[model samples]
Target: MKVLSGIHEPTKGTITINNINYNKLDHKLAAQLGIGIIYQELSVIDELTVLENLYIGRHLTKKICGVNIIDWREMRVRAAMMLLRVGLKVDLDEKVANLSISHKQMLEIAKTLMLDAKVIIMDEPTSSLTNKEVDYLLSSISDHESVA
Candidate 1:
């Protein structure tokens, strides 16, 4: 796999993105090439809000001279938009610990969308959801792919 470079011979087969081979790219460069992964076990911050969990410290780049400050308002708007895009309607200010499992999963996806990635890999995202919830999620993914 290109992720781990287990294929050994990079020249034999190339993993290309935007016409560039992934095997030739550095780890950080490859990571930044629009690939995002969401693990089955979420490591979200319990104390932070849904919006804060999504943006973390990156929300402050607008007003802050350095990376030390966070622009709460901008982050909230972006996080809210991402939540809307993922079809989850939750209070962006609510703590992650208070959210239900389904809501948490949606929030995690919303966070991924906020990163503006071209590829998103979800691992067992609906393993624990109810039938209705799973249907909704599958439908959403299908709808997105259809449009794409």
Candidate 2:
């Protein structure tokens, strides 16, 4: 998975996606190719709000008087939609530290979806989830597959 996601290079074989073969790939290129990964460890920032985490590095921005301003409203709307798709409903202003393990896992999934990844590789996604949460996660993934 690390090789495929471009976090590490393969020493043996080449990787082909969409009929394009890559002998060398970087993280940015992999993401541009619509590949996303969710590691077993949660990556959420405890200090950030849900909305902030969702758009951490890629915030929507608008120019005002030649100044680039973060568009909070647009980020909120898109974050809400992505969270809904992952069956996670929480206050956008809520800090991630206050969320449960399952909620944090769902937030990670939502963050991956926000990247518009066509292929998402999750590592032990259900390891921390309860039986019911696992069922719901599986169902949500199935629903997304059907839509795609």
Best by TM-score: 2
Off by over 4 Å in 1: 1-14, 24-27, 63-69, 141-148
Measured by TM-score, how close is model 1 to the native structure?
0.71
Alpha carbon lDDT of each predicted model: 0.68, 0.85
Worst 10 residues of 2 by lDDT: 139-148
Per-residue error (Å), model 1, residue 87:
2.9
lDDT digits (tens) for residues 1-148 of candidate 2: 8897778889987899989899968989989988888888999999999998898899999999999999988888888887877778799999999999999998998888788787888888878888887787678777553222
Against the true structure, candidate 2 reaches a TM-score of: 0.89
> Would you estimate the TM-scores of all the predictions?
0.71, 0.89
RMSD of each: 4.3, 2.2
Worst 10 residues of 1 by lDDT: 1-10
Per-residue lDDT of model 1, residues 1-148, tens digit only: 3452232446655678777665454545544776655667776788998877997645655535554655677777777777776677789888999988888887776676666666766777777577777777667656432112
**Model 2 misplacement above 4 A:** 65-67, 145-148
* lDDT score at residue 16, model 2, on the 0-100 scale: 92
